[model samples]
Target: MPLITIIGAGPGLGLEIARAFGQKGFDVALVARDQSKLDALAQTLAGEGIHAQGFTADVSVPATITNALQSIRETLGPIDVLEFSPADRTLESVDALKVTMENLQPQIDFYLGGAVTAVGAVLPDMIESNTGTILVTTGGGSLAPTPARGNINIAAAGLRNWTLNLNSALADTGVYVALVAITALIGGGRPDAEPAVIAKEYVKLHAERRDAELHYVAYDR
Candidate 1:
């Protein structure tokens, strides 16, 4: 079975994504900071008959992410699909006017730096094998700046830009790269914005391997 590594795996979209891929015969390796939570997620997937294992890692710390990916590779085979979507719950967003290097740096480290580290760890093997899929998740703020999440938007935008560029660079390498920018509150009453609904897009992206990005906009504004 193919293996998919979901960084920042949690109870929401992460779990749904795992289920979607698992339904399609992909074994899952969930990476997150909380071991207990990860274990719970793994158990849940197991109950669903999806072979899954959890690896703990804090995306803010590049070393931890690297170590977790190495462990995942050792436990499950090489990653066929890499989905990065870490939620940083510790940092508080500042307004655009209040943004500073101190405030913005952490977002940079979490969003952009983490992605670089994770991709670097697996890209070599994917390139050698000539088959892989990379799916990155960000918020709508990354595409259109909002005053509330200034630092996050900046960092996410950087990640989005890099992902698109990487897609272009790997055009003929058999490694597909795509980004999913969610523009609504997931599971926030809208049927279209539910986690399960959104997750189907990930599976579609991997299967089709055509689009560079998908903007899952389920909001009015």
Candidate 2:
């Protein structure tokens, strides 16, 4: 079975992507900060007859990420598809930001940094093995000028460009690096945003090609 590692796993898109791929018979690794939440997701997946494993991981914390990945690798074997779908901070304007852990740039970096670092570690194995897919979920870099969601924009842009650079370098070697850029609001449809259709489009991009680097919306894909 194809083993898929989902980083930044949260409630909405994260779980939806998980279930979507899980239906395709992939062994899904659910990574999150809350063990109980991951456990619950894993249990729920079990009912679908899909092999799922939960790992307690904090995206900003390097040690926790390494430990969690190691644990998941031990439990479910090597990962074939890597999806980074972490839900950190909202892409709110600076003026709209209030005081909270989720209101800061460091909070964004915590998950972003962890995801990249973990991917760095895992890439060597995938490269040596000459296979695997790396899918990074875009936060708010889809806008032309980009969203002013504090540091999340920075981290998300980093992920987006990093995937491009990495994909360019690894294309000949068979390591597929791609992006799932969702420009719509988190609520599926806000005043004027459609996240679901954008998400499904992302899935299609990956499913159609082995080597594809795509952007979600309002930008060159």
Which candidate gets the maximum lDDT versus the true structure? 1
Best by TM-score: 1
Clashes of each: 0, 2
The alpha-carbon RMSD values of the candidates against the true structure, listed in the order shown, are 1.3, 4.5
TM-score list, all predictions: 0.98, 0.82
Model 2: how far is 152 from its true place, Å? 2.4
lDDT by residue (18-88, candidate 2, tens digit) is 77787777888999889899888888888888788789877767888888878877888887888877664
| Shift in Å, residue 172, candidate 2 | 1.3
lDDT of 1 by residue, 1-221 (tens): 99999999999999999999999999999999899999999999999999999999988889999999999998998999999999887886899999999999999988999999999899989989999999999999989868899889999999999999999999999999999999988988888889999999999999999999998899543
Q: What is the lDDT of residue 169 in candidate 2?
A: 88
Cα distance off (Å), candidate 1, residue 59:
0.6
Q: How many angstroms is residue 205 displaced in model 2 relative to the true structure, after the best TM-score fit?
A: 3.2
